[model samples]
Target chain A: MRYLVPLLLSTLVWWILTEAAQAWVVGVPVILVSTWVAVRLQDTDSGSAPTHRLNWFAVPRFALFFLWQSLQAGLDVAKRTLKPVPDINPGTLYYYTSIPHGTARYFFGAIVGLFPGTLCTEFSEDTDQLVLHVLDTDVDIALDCRRLEREIERLFKLPAADQQGRPA
Target chain B: MNLAFDIVLGLALLLTALGVFSSKDLFRAVVMFIAFGLLLALVWVRLDAPDLALAEAAIGAGLTGVLMIDAVAHLSANTLQNDQRDDQYDHSPKRPLWLPVISCVGLFVLLLGAIRFRPEASVSLPDMVRDNIAESGVEHPITAVLLNFRSYDTLLEIAVLLVAVVVAMALKPAAEDRVHQPPPAHDPILHGLTARLLPAMLLVGMYVLWAGSYMPGGAFQGGAILAAALVFLQLAGFAVDRYAASLLRLGLALGFLVFLTVAVSVMIGGRPFLTYPEGFAGQLIFFIEAMLTLSIGLILFSLFSQNPPHSGAVGHQGANHDQ
Candidate 1:
């Protein structure tokens, strides 16, 4: 039942994305089978990490923010790297996250690279932390990260971190 | 201006290729090879072959990079931890390089000579393809060629992929490649992104697959994207167990099974093998492609995964990193 909602939503998405009207006769089956395969593949023991918990209403707003930030990042990277002197200080720093260790942590690794002046170099299992390479030290990149995390928390509607440090 | 862009792209490709072959550092060489693949994709675009561009960019560059990086990580495990210099991995070839160098140069010249002196064709091939494309089921000539005009070739290609998966499974890279890796730390950023991106990526993959009927996309490109999304999930800490493994195996076999069933059914219905009935050609082809898309997606993902990749099971590292 946990997989049902995502499966149905994904199937609908699959049909529309595949332009089902072209061959309506066979379209529904194709999308359903593929979505089932996807759902099966994403089977997880960690309930808190499931994507279905996300607040769908906040998605577009988050996407816009992500896009604008990425553009800014792109421009910043281009300027610093393309300059005659390469006005940049490259260094790595650790970021401790409270999101679950599975899909959520992995998504952050990919996304952090797109953020301005910061790239996720590694996520250490022992430390429960991410190693981020930053272009500038003067900027409060951690503050930016926290802000992004706030937006993401709202979007995913992940249980707020409790006093005991476990997500509810 | 176009000529200049072409020249630059060509030069970059050549340089990257050379770097890939000649670099002493194994890591640098692999990186250069990935860059070479990206440049090759651009060259394909310049040549007006968007289908090839998409495949090259996705499979040739993206997935290949992932595989090579995985391999390098395995290789460097010993050298980095032990602080011992392994001189066995020499840059120079053990055998004389002259023979390979001479033969390659000879082949290059011969190919150049053949193209330069080739006779002009009396028949216009594009006109021929365009003329019969309507009867070929799909609107795109390339898809038509792949599915109808020369479906046997596509079948054989799927067979090749099947053989690759079977061989990989037999080789036990599946067991040694994964281990009891620690789960990822809580990361809200990743959690949020996955929630948003996975479905969207899947949608884009389907878009590409569907568009292949009329445009510059296909099962391979779409499957690569799907495989990438799954890989992202895997890297994020998703566990694959026995049940998931069997389901993935089913996905690996789905394409061939569907294709064979469709072909044999057509024969049983008194039509020639692989020839669809008059009014149902498009529907049949779409059905086959849809199955192929899932199979290809699962198979490609399994190429790197161990354990039950499709349904989520715990995996042990099969590829032993002997330091």
Candidate 2:
């Protein structure tokens, strides 16, 4: 039912947005059949589907944080670019992941990559480490790692680890 | 206010382009290039091409950004020395200044001559569709052109999209399988904002899509917006796996199927191929546009995701420090 609502909502929104009213009789059936086909395809490929746990109340705060961070990062990049000579020292660094779940880990990698000067190269399962290449190795690498770790951890509600493991 | 805004936007565009061209870091260059697309969309809007503006925002800025980033990601994984070599290459080459100056002068002369020699007027195409506009069904001229006048072009374009997808699939590396790792759970504040913004964005996107028939938007713009909103949701830690793939496939096929079905139905109804009966054109046009939007959005997102085969559910891990 939870999934059904979003699906219906998206379908309806898609229908209306496309102004499919004239062809609604035809379009509705198309959308439904296609949507169903899509669902079956997902089931076959990924095996498990994501369940939406609606926490409607928490949305606005996250958006504000994202906006603020994006703005800050944008400014930082602009400043670095305007310098007389680019002060960048490129290097690759490996960081370990604390997020256990696959979904959480992917989200973290994407968010960190969103920032300027960082590109995540690979995630290794054998050693449980993430490889990131950075343009400015002179910048505080550990600090950036901690910032990303905290942000992602907070977003996913993952278990906290100290230098060892403990609740923060 | 407008002037100030324009100045800022212009500067942003210049900076973005300069960043794209001048940056020694390839990844940074890719990111800047994406930013340049966004800035270019703004420029399009300022130039009073809202249709182009919307398309630029969705396909140009959004989709292209995804593709470039994916390409960069792929490149980074395979080579370390290549980056160093590229840096060296940037400094080693310069096409002589006089060559670019001569080319620019030559282009200017050709454009001026072409403009000067152009005919003052030209005959418009036969208005066979004017008396039949109401009967032809679609109201918008461009839509009419697309579905009724030049449907073969539209069909071929869809074929092109399919071909591009297949080509990309074939070219993608076999070992590059990985899913984006979820961000660590962030503060409640961040999550709250994302949730609030998503529905509103979706709402606006729908409005753009629906309003396209009468106003500046249609499916392509609307669908791109919708896709972007979904991408944002994905980034925000919204667990949204249920219909992503299937929805994508359906979206891709929707336009081609509907257009074909309707064209065939018309034939069954005793009209020529691609002919719409009286009062059915607008609806049919709407149908095609909607499907096209979905297809475009899906194709673009898939292009951006650029997932390689056989990587098999690898989670997006953190930045790997080791090159």
Candidate 3:
């Protein structure tokens, strides 16, 4: 019964799409046969977690935040480029994150990489620490990193201790 | 008035280019690059090349975005630590601002001169395509060119897709390490909505495929839509099968078989090569495209799978079907 829906749906789609060929009278049966053969040959069981439970409402918020940050980062880089002295103070720093799941961790790392001078170099799954490289090493830069960390924590709903960890 | 719009578009393109070059974040840079590709596609449309615009949107923006995102994911997984030297070097000696300024000026001047001093065409090829449009077997000029005038290029492009699949299969690690964690739980209403919409989405995909001959649909778009459906199923935890090796092989090879067989039979009919028999062109093309759609869908689904087929991993159990 579980397989029946998908099979019927696939067959219906295959028939409609091939209807224009004017050969559908013959083509539909061929496709159905092939589909059945394909299904039979497939491994009906593989142990991977299903991703059915997506947080739908958070998606738009995530997208908007990413867009705003991307724009801000773009402008920041442009300004640095236009400046005479370049004003670069580069340094690599280590920071810990409280995001437990791998997906959230990866998303956090990716979002951090969008800032003007920051690059997420490595994420240690065991320690939940991320190594980041920043072009500007000033005090303002540290504050900005903390701001980003807080934002990430807020978005992912991390614990307070992980959010307040020492900036390495 | 129209000139102002064109100027604005050009400036936007330039700004995007600058952003892509200057952005420190690699992922953002890639996203900007995709935006740049989209803008370029618009520029192509403005230049009266709708075909090029479509191709750029699909191949340039869509496919390239997928490839870049995959690359970024792989790079993030591999790099253990951020190098400190990158920051130290930023504080060192800086290049003169005049260098970039001079280069930009030089490039602009060269472009202006080239456009102003454009050469005149010497001769014109006979409009064989326009003249034979009625007899070309396809209603659309672009279709005629693709499947008739330059069929070989299209064939070779399909071959390239095959090679990509083969290469991915060859390089994939033998061990199936499933790293994709389950998505966070969502509202029951949203889940129910997704369930209801799945069937409708499949219908739309089919309609697009069927409409390709006369309209703006084709194997690629149809295939992508089908792949998305499959991806959705996988995400929804439906028909969780991970060891469908035989099915995978058949899906991957279906298009290649149909294309080859048709091409060879043309030779048997004493045609030069890949020439469809009169009154049969539409049928043959449709057959080939249908097969191609399946192949493309299967290949894309496989590429997006976290675990390779035959990895001996127990597939996820859920309400949806597996690809």
Candidate 4:
């Protein structure tokens, strides 16, 4: 029963790829065998703490915001490049984040990657400090990182980074 | 309008290629080479070869760039900046360069001759393919040519890829640099993103594979996309188990196995080897592609595992998610 979801999904994938209903004679068996193989191939630890517990509602909202931000950033960067006297001051700085270590941190990095002014060069393992290279030092990039951090927290339902382990 | 676009893209491609080879720094060369690949993909697109373009952008520009960058990172760690100083000081006698230069020139002239003569004889090939493409089990000319008209080439290609993977696996997996600290397991945002993205990536990968019968994608493109997604998951810190590694090896070999089995099985039915029974060619090819897509995806992703399959490579949440 635990394997049902992946099985169904893999079957759907197989059907989409094969696309011959009449060929079910061979397709069904092949699909089943392959799906069984896939199930066996997955890491056993995958199901222990699946990421689906996140608040689903914030995802689309975040995606829309991110896409718009990306467009704006791309245009801004393009403008900076083509201008005769480019008003840009590039510098690297550290952003201390509260996003949890595992996927959340990775997600945050990915998000930061798309933003206009900042590119994340590295994240410290010892501390939650993200090294960011920014196009403009004048911009309140720290505040912006914090704002994104808050949105991620809302989306992931994480406790505040500073307030971790605090009881409700 | 389009002419200007073509001229610019062509210039960019040439310049980027020149930059890649001429750059003294290995890192700079790798980056420039990736740029060249991307520009080449654009040229493929301008030439109306979308299938080739897709493969170029995905495998050529994308995966190749990642692979080269990985190689550069490892190489740079112990790299000597001696090349710069050596270039300025020790000038060895420039002998033995003429033979290689002459051979390269001869090869170039030979290619130019081929291009000059191609138009006279090449026109019939497409017409000939189009005339009998219906019986070839696919709507797209490239797919038909790949799977039916010239299946031996495809079979041999799959065998070669299998050999490459086996050879790579024989190498000791690179020691991971991220042995510092294990990230906490309950990263809610990462989990959420993975859960959302994985399904979509799988869907797109399968869609590309399915659409290949009539469209601009096939096993290779779909397989690359799926492999990238799987690698992304691993890089995000999913602990793949040992049993899963063996299971994946089976999956990795599945494509060649199925291709060979079908090829041999068809011979038992009195047809030539790899020539599917007339009525069942489409089904058989579709089946083979489904298997090929899975096998290719897993094999390509496994190439990036940097760990022995028996141990099941662990994905540590490194500083960079894109890694």
Complex DockQ per candidate: 0.24, 0.08, 0.05, 0.17
Please tell me which model should have the higher lDDT, number 1 or number 4. Answer: 1
Per-candidate local distance difference test: 0.74, 0.62, 0.64, 0.72
Candidate 4 C-alpha lDDT tens digits along A1-168? 546666676667656665644445544564565455445434333454333235668889888778888898999899998999997999987777777765567677877878879888876656777788999888877777776787888788777666322111
Candidate 4 wrong stretches, greater than 4 Å: A1-53, A58-83, A90-134, A139-168, B80-93, B117-119, B170-196, B233-245, B302-323
Models 1 onward score TM values of 0.76, 0.57, 0.56, 0.73
Per-residue lDDT for B1-323 in model 2, tens only? 99899999999899889998888666677778878888888898898778777789777777677656655555555444355653453364755789878998999999999999988666555466565445545565545565668878887787687677767666766542433433423322234445544554655555665566555776667778767765655444455444555666676677778878887898987899877777667777777777776776666555544455222122221123122
| Regions more than 4 Å wrong, model 2 | A1-168, B1-19, B81-101, B123-145, B148-150, B174-207, B226-251, B268-270, B307-323
What does candidate 3's lDDT look like per residue over B1-323, in tens digits?
Answer: 87887889899999999998887666677789899999988988887766567667765787566556555544443332334433442253677989889999999999999999999766543377778767666666666776677778878877887788888877766544433534423322223334545655555555555566666666766677666666655545554335447688788888877888899888986997788889988878877877887887777777666333321122221111111
Better of 1 and 2 by lDDT: 1
Best model per DockQ:
1
- lDDT tens digits, residue span B10-98, model 1: 99999999999887777777778889999999999999999999999988998888777666655555454544565556445579889
Q: Write candidate 2's Cα lDDT for A1-168 as tens digits.
A: 524644676567666655665635544554454455344433432323232233345446656767777786787778878899866678887777666534456556667766766777876535557788887777766566666666656665555646522211
What is the CA-based DockQ of model 3? 0.05
Which ten residues in a row are the worst by lDDT in model 4 chain B?
B311-320
lDDT, residue A145, candidate 4: 79
- iRMSD of prediction 2: 9.5
Off by over 4 Å in 1: A1-84, A89-134, A139-168, B78-85, B93-97, B173-196, B306-323
